[model samples]
Target: MDPTNGDEKKKRFQEAFERGRDGHVGSYNVWLENHGFDPSRVDRDKVTEFFRENPTKSVNQDDVTDIAEYAGFVTTRQDLHHIPVIGPSGIGKTQLLHTVIGLLSEVDDDIDTKLLEANRLGKKTEDGFLLDEYSRQIAELTTPIVCIDDCGLDKRIRTSLRELRDAVDAGLFVTTWTPERWGVNQDQVRDVFSPAKEVHLRSFTQSETKGTLRVIYDYISQDNFALPSKTEERIHELSDGIPRLIHLLALESLREAYHKELVPGHISATDAAADRLNLSNASARVQDLSEARLTVLKQILQLPDERGVQPGTLVDELHRDKSTISYHLRELNEIGFVERDRKGRRAFYRVTETIEPLVQRRISQEAEYNA
Candidate 1:
């Protein structure tokens, strides 16, 4: 071959580098946009101002560290696939995953990524087309990193989730679900996502809750606003270490203040608590609660908090088949109307504290109407 012209050769190399780098960054930006981050909407000035005015408070270090570790593996295109991040609902599973994916996209534009929510998976009647579409889309992407949030929430999608095995083998999967869906043991968890690494997310500590509230207040407030100590403490108490509840409480409290036309000041903890209870009642009402299930819920609520009702007691009281009682209890637990606890080897189920007040209120109203 003839010797290359120096200027032309340098120009060709530069062009190739630019194309590669551009392709990488372009892919990442697309991922971020698809996941709802659309960087163009980001207000860099506001972010910079917030950082300057309020020093960053450390919270969710474990969550950040774990997600970053897995994200690093995914970005590097490693074989460490099937990451199941387990936590209760509203414990920041989706938020943590989004942040990790956002950071990964920023750093590696070439990586393929997709997010699927379990509840969004259509009903069994509609799953055929959905799965076909999922297969088609996944086929087009190369080594797609798929994060399926709330994996165990719906029964309709369990079969579809099983179909993800192919993707798990060929690419990577990061899923989040509650521990109640499956036990914490590796074998038990493997039923949901086999041969997987588990990242157990802890609920927010009281300090983390305060830090998070402050962070939220800073982000939404236009001025130097301070959350009252009592308001913060009440939020911490009623929120029960769940970040989603914390967010809901904060927003509802603000709305309460707004409705009262009060100057932007302290968010009333009482108002937040009432809104949360109302929300719980509304949610409980909307769910398809069969008479059997409702009766089961009522009984669970009557049981003392420390001593949750057992399946045998439910069977005795309802005169229902053991399997039927178990099914109803499982449904209630899944909807969060009930919580399951373990003492020794036996599992006990009880109505969740959040729903207790609503249940009691309904009972009182019914009694009054009867009288």
Candidate 2:
């Protein structure tokens, strides 16, 4: 995005916040009561976080450890009063807080716990529903264990919410949302969460991405469904260890490959899951390949499957330099236009099954255009 566009957007949010802060947005004055926001220090993203939708997926491996630790912290030290869990969006912060609520109940069966997303609490703000009712619910909690998901989204009422948590002596578990992978969760954490032992979550690691996919794979295995062999590596590469991207790409790829439609009422299954988005991009990109690389791909498409062609074979068949052949082969494999098979220290290449027809179509078009 253009820097000026972002600056303008930020300016709008700051102006809106000022209206709320100065009591000009009279009905919404509850947000500034004890929320501790300084007009001089307003964070555009944190203060106006309702712009994003939370991405929820299966529990990742790191999240399991986080859940255990957080549940442990709350159960053993009830004196801390409030523990804010903060991280960039799609890092599973909301999922972690929700799990912690469940774990807290298991840790002590008698413990009462409730999970309320921040949006639900302040959803009626535009309808003139004073959030004081939600505040009252929090204030009178018989079960002092509370989980507030994505607290950044409704920060307008943060001061009132904090007071409610304190009034009930609640063991508040919260996650404040921030963006992901844009300069590494770039946001002003302090602008939203005060540093009272706030837990900062990290992005997913490659291993964690693979582990999360494996959990999904276990379910597909019973139906004999399988994905491409290198999917795990490719997904990890594409996601760069961001949990939301990892799951989105993996599930979409798997569903497209399996030719499956979502069952009724399963809202999370994307309607476009069967779209060959990556493959379509690869086709367009393949058309733009250098003459040398296109020749290499043409040969790979001709190579027989299972026993594919080696780089040395391409070098001899196409009369290309060995290093040039190797470079193009690596590029094709990375682009998902071709697959590499490893056998006892030897590597062979062929057009990927799903991409073979697309590659052939591009090659045919090139031949016709040249003719």
Candidate 3:
């Protein structure tokens, strides 16, 4: 959530309440759809009453205060250069960036800051030649405080952001997503956005602030439930303060609490939320593995036991060539999907815990399709 003053925070929350009252297709709506729950089935009146009573917290003072102080206010413009907030996927980099935007807006009310969301950066647009027209428009901006979220989404998007990349006053407050576990080339991204104040989001101890907790509960309370402090702490532990995971797991936990349940961790509610989606998606992207790798993984996943299965066995059972199976097997192992154990002469491969849920989901989808 973006931060504001006390009154503004309340106003902002109220606005969200009104906006989501009609069941706007935001995260909550998406979450319901993803979990195969009917959004239309939920009691809107009950949810609305719960939100009005609870009054979800919207102010995150720490986010702005820490970032602004780090940016060095009242000091020289040099002290307040463009800051890049880098972190793993789902670690709330974009949320922090939005908070930074809110904080920076206080400096000048009349002037508007620019924001380029890399995810939404499509090539064509309704406004004519997309890059040419956009580049022209941004180049003319008086206040070039361009805030770009995840410029790494596409290297080509950086080509359109020359003004920010090359300027000081009119520069980028960029949030670069750098999850190395997902096989992202960190150095390549860093070099592209070089000569900026790089703040790698390594420490995630307090990512789930009180404001975040209240914000999440606003959605949960829609189910007519209260978030216990014990359950909250358990969620933080499981999510490791990642916002997406926190939101999903908290809602999943809230669902559990309805049936007199304890806190649901990643493993417990992984089927509920695709927490490892990034890991699986990244493996596919980085390797350009196509469906062949997934085919091999599905086969490996079907195999029984932690004792593991041999490549020769997979070759015989899958009716695929040994070399084809071996190629994907090696790549899958590199992506942490499968673990290989060599018992002196022969090697045995078994599916790792990280990708078990994804494989299971795929298997289920296949079963449903076949039926």
Candidate 4:
């Protein structure tokens, strides 16, 4: 094929890709509405009401409100502004961003909101063109809020965020992210975008947890199950003030109570036990423990002379499948629970000191049980 022909084909492919992405956003909006979430636009009053109703769970409500106000103010004064919402995982960062976009839509119906997952966008073959495409989309919108959820997860897209910063500085962009692992200092963060406010959303407070319980109770009220105050307190304690965890615990508790026909009144001891069992099951599923990784760590622990297992020996002992072991090791390393030491060409991994005791306890428990 001729070079010009190839170039034309590539351009067409890029257009198709962007069109598909826009369609996805539209479909997601429809889905949200179908699921009873108001996706049309978030109005200030509606957002305020939501915050008021869901009071205690406002991890960073004040900061979020301030950012939204600033974004609204900037657009009123000028043409555009960029606001980045930053926080750790499960800190309600994504929900807050969506709420802001909803608010923006209320202020201006012409305002268009596009939700993009950075990891998904990063997988595109024509990712290099995304920033330009995003800028064009923003330019065409009467009001635009481009929400890039999980922005810092993809290094390529994050580097490209500088281009977005340029657009924002030029009055054409807005974005958000949960920046738990960005590892950037304040100066670096500030340099990325003008009028960029980094709002740190911490975990829920104890009060917030109790409020979250109230919300959960309201949600499950249709089932005619009313949890006792003591049960609620126990659920809150187990949830550690994490909204998602609280929801999970509450749902599990309700399910258990219903299973035992203990709904609409004081929960029985059996119902509480069932709830505890459900919680344990849910936690185990989410923990993603790697047996092979655990085994390797166990062997290292068992060896009296060696402080750590030889990389090759460890691989041989685990012995299931090379790819599976490699994948588990990569995951463990990424999560900071494990680390590798390189001595020239050879690499050896050891359980991080913090995790060593936990691994030892698990192994010892298994050994005792087996014996």
The best candidate in terms of lDDT:
1
> Model 4: runs farther than 4 Å from truth?
1-60, 79-82, 125-132, 168-180, 184-190, 223-225, 259-371
lDDT of each: 0.61, 0.53, 0.53, 0.53
Model 2 lDDT per residue over 1-371, tens place: 56579888898889989875643453222232223222221222321121122212344435445545554565567643445664545556656665565555556877667676665565566544445565566566553666666554553534545545555643544545432211122234334334345555665677677776665444333432333436666665554455555555654553332234333112222224313435334445656778777778667544433377888899898998998888888887776767788898989887665454344445645544775
Can you write out model 4's per-residue Cα lDDT over 1-371, one digit (the tens) per residue? 66579888998779878955543245544443443334332122343355434444444367667766766665566655556665434446666766666666666776566766665544444545565676556556544566777655545554556765445433434444433223332245456555455555555677667666665454434333345777666665555444545554554443344446554323463246434533333333334566766665555444322234455565676665667666766776775556777777766677664344344434434544775
**lDDT of prediction 4:** 0.53
Model 3 residue 26 CA deviation (Å) reads 19
Residue-wise C-alpha lDDT for candidate 3, range 177-227, written one tens digit per residue:
443211233444445555355555532354444346555454543443344
- Candidate 2 deviant stretches above 4 angstroms: 1-78, 125-130, 179-193, 224-229, 255-371
Q: How much is the lDDT of residue 240 in candidate 4?
A: 43
Off by over 4 Å in 1: 1-61, 74-80, 122-127, 156-158, 184-192, 258-371
Q: Where does candidate 3 have its weakest 10-residue lDDT segment? A: 177-186
Q: What TM-score does prediction 3 earn?
A: 0.51
lDDT score at residue 124, model 4, on the 0-100 scale: 46
